[model samples]
Target: MNLETTSSWFLMAAFVLYCAAFIGFVLAVTGRRWADRSPEQHQRKWGWVSFGISAAGFGAHLAFFFTRWAAAGRIPTSNMFEFMTFLAMMTTAAFLIIYALYRSPVLGAFAMPVGFVLLAYAAVFPQEISPLIPALQSHWLMIHVTTAAAGEAFFAVGFAAGLMYLLRVVNFKPTTSGGRAQVFFVELTIFTVLAIVGFVGTVFTFKGAGYEAVFLQEKSSVDQKGQLTTTEETVTYTMPPIVKPYNSEMVRMTPFLGMKEPLFETPSWMNGVNAGRKLNTVVWSLLTAAIMYAALRLILRKPIGAAIQPALDGMDPEDLDEISYRAIAIGFPVFSLGGLVFAMIWAHKAWGRFWGWDPKETWAFITWLFYTIYLHLRLSRGWLGRRSAWMAVIGFVVVMFTLVGVNLVIAGLHSYAGV
Candidate 1:
C-alpha cells in the first residue's frame, strides 16, 4: 500500500485495539464494583489485563502517528484531523504514566474512553495529506503543536480523574441544590460523551448525503487601474458554513428541513466556513445525544449517571482529586512553554509579529489563564475536593475550546487548523 493507505490501515488497527481496551476497562470497573471480596482478586487480574490491552493499543497508536508523520513529511499537527489523533495518543500516554505512578485501574476506565472517543472523532475529519502552508512549513510547527497537545493530554487525564471524583462525591439523590447541580453536571458529562460518539457515527453515516448550504463569499481583485476592488459571489457548501472571508454572500439551503435563508457573515474576526461546520456538527451531536439518552432510559430506566454511581462507591475521592490536580500542575508549565512561548517565537518568525491576538491565540491564552487560576486557587487559595475537581474539569474545557472550538469557530491568523 501507498503511505496514506498504509497509514490508514495502521490507524484503523489502532482504533480496533482502542475499542478492545475500552471494553476491558469497562469490565475492570464493573467487575470490581459487583464482585465479592473473594473475586476482588479477580478484579485485580482484570485490571492488569485491561492495562495491558491499552498499553498495546498505545504502541499501535504511536506507530500510526509516526506513519502519518512520515507520509506528510512533517509532524502531523497542521489540521484538526491530525492534531485530534495526536491528542488522543498523548492522552493515552498520559494515562499510562499516571497508571505507573498511581496504579489505579479506575483512571483507565475513564481515561481510555476519552481517547477512544477522540480517535473516533478524528476519523470524521477528512484525512488526506496535503502540502504545508507557508506559515506551517517550519520545524517549530512540530515543537509548538506537539508540546501543546502533550500538555492537553495531561489535562485530559485530569479531566477523567476529576470527573470520577465528582461522581464519587456528588450525592446520588441530590436533595440539595448544590448536590443537584453536581448531578446535572454528571449527567451532562454522560450526554456529551454519548453525543460525541454519536456524532462520529452520524457524520459518517450521512457522509455522502450532500447536505448543501450556500454562502455569499466576498472576493477581491486588482482593477484595470492597478487598484484593489472587492466583490461578492454566492457560494454553496456541503456542510455548514461557519466562517468565511469578508463579505461573502452565502445562500443557506437545507432541503431536508425545507429551510432556506440568506447566510450572513460572522464577526469579521470570527466568520469562516469552518465555524458554521462546527456549529452544525454540534447540532448533530445533540440530536444523537437525545436519541441515545432515550434508548438508554428505556433500557436502564434511570439517568445514566445513576447506573455508574454505584461503581464509584468507596473509591477515594480525595486521591482522584489530587491526581487530577497534580496532572494540571504538571501540564501548565509545558503548555505555557510550548503554546505561548514557542508559539510567539514561531509567530514572530513567520508573520513578523509576536502577539497579533488572533482568535486561536486569544483562546490559547484564555486556556492558559484558566489553568493558572485553577492552580493558584488550589495550591495557594486552599481549594480542594469537589471545588478543585470542578476547577480541573473546567480547565480541561478551556483546553478543549483552545484545541477544538477555536479552530472550528473562528477565522484567524492560525489558519492551519482547517483543511
Candidate 2:
C-alpha cells in the first residue's frame, strides 16, 4: 500500500486499540472488587497486558506519522487533522513517561479517553494528499509544530489529573467509610452521562444538518451616461442549517431568490474563511458559555472533606497533587520553547514576520499564558491541591483552543490541512 493508505490503516488500528485501552483502564478503576477477589498473579498479568496494549497503540501512531511524512515529502504538521494526530501521539508518549516514573494506572483512565477523542476527530477531515505551501516547506516546521504539540499533550494529561483530583476532593472523604467513594462514583457517572448526551446533541445539531446557502440584496442608484440607473447586488451566505432542539437537523433552508451565481461555488479558500467566521462567532460562544457555567457550578459545590486526604485507602492526596505540579512544570518549559519561541522563529523565516497574530499563533500564546499563570500561582501564592488543580483544569481549555479550536474555528495562513 501507498504511505498515505498505510498511515490511514495505522490510525484506524490505533483508534481501535485506544478504545480498548480506555475500556480496560475503566475496568481497572471501577471494577476494583473483581481485582481484589482475583489472585495477585492475575492482577499483575492484567497490568502488563494493559500497558502492552497502550504501548502497541503508541507504536502504531508513530508509524502512522512517519509514513505520512514520507508520503507528503515533508512534515505533517500543516493542518488540524495532522496536528491532532501528533497531539494524540504526544499524549501517549507523555503518559508513558509519567507512568514510568510514578507507576500510576489511574492517569490512563483519562489520558486514553482524551487521546481517543483526538484521534477520532482527526478522522473527520479528508486524508488526501496535503500539498505544502511555500511557507510550510521549511525544516523549522517540524521542530516548531512537534514540540508545541508535545507540550500541549503534557498539559492535556495534567487536565485529566486535575479533574480526577477535583472529583476526589469534592465527593469523597478519604478517612471515612465508603460514603465518599459512593459520592465520587455517582459524580463520575453523572459526568459521563452528561458528556455522552452533549456529544450526541452537538453531532446531530451540527454535522447532521447539511449545508445551505443564504443571500442578501443591496440596491444602489448611480449616474450612467447622464442618466440615473438603479442596480441591485446580491450577496450570498452559505453554511449548514442550524439545529434548534438537541440533535435536530430538520431546520428548513431559506429559498434562494434572485442571485448572480451560487454562493458556495466560490473557491475553497473563501469557503474556509466563511466557515471559520461562523464557528468563531456562533459555536465558540456557546462552548465558552457552557464551560463557564460548569466552572461556576464546581466552585459553588461544597467540599465534602477538609485538608488533604488520601484519594484511596493507600493513595495520598499530596502525592497526586505533587505529581500534577511536576507534570505542569515539565510541560511549561517545553511549551515556551516549542510553542512560542520556536514557532515565532519559524513564522519569521516562512511568513516574513515573527508574530502575525494568526489564530493558531494567538491560541498558542494563550495556552502558554494559561500555564505561566498556573506556575506562577503554584509557586508565589502557594496554591497547591484544589486551587492548583483548578488552574490545571483551566489550562486544558487553553490547550484545547490551541490544538483544535484554532484550526476548526479560526481562519489564518496556516489553513492548509483539512480540519
Instruction: Check candidate 2 and list the clashing pairs.
Output: none
Candidate 1 runs further than 4 Å off? 33-37, 208-270
> Cα RMSDs of all predictions?
3.5, 8.8
What TM-score goes with each of the models?
0.88, 0.72
- Kindly list the per-residue Cα lDDT of model 1 for residues 34-72, writing each as its tens digit: 666654575677778888888888888888888888888
Name the weakest run of 10 consecutive residues (lDDT summed) in model 1: 236-245
Q: Residues 1-419, candidate 2: write the lDDT tens digits.
A: 78899998998888888878777665655555566476334434554566678999999998999999899888887776788788888988887777677766567766677787777656545567768778887889889888888888888778777766765656454466566664554354334424433443454344455434343332333465676665433332233323111111222345423433322322233333334333422442355446644764577563322222232334456767876787788888988999999989998998789998987788778878878888888899999997888688777866765554555554577655434
Taken over the whole model, the C-alpha lDDT of each candidate is 0.79, 0.65
Global local distance difference test of model 2: 0.65
Model 1 RMSD vs true structure: 3.5
Q: Where is the poorest 10-residue window by lDDT in model 2?
A: 241-250
Runs with alpha carbons beyond 4 Å of true place in candidate 2: 36-44, 172-240, 243-272, 276-314, 407-410, 415-419
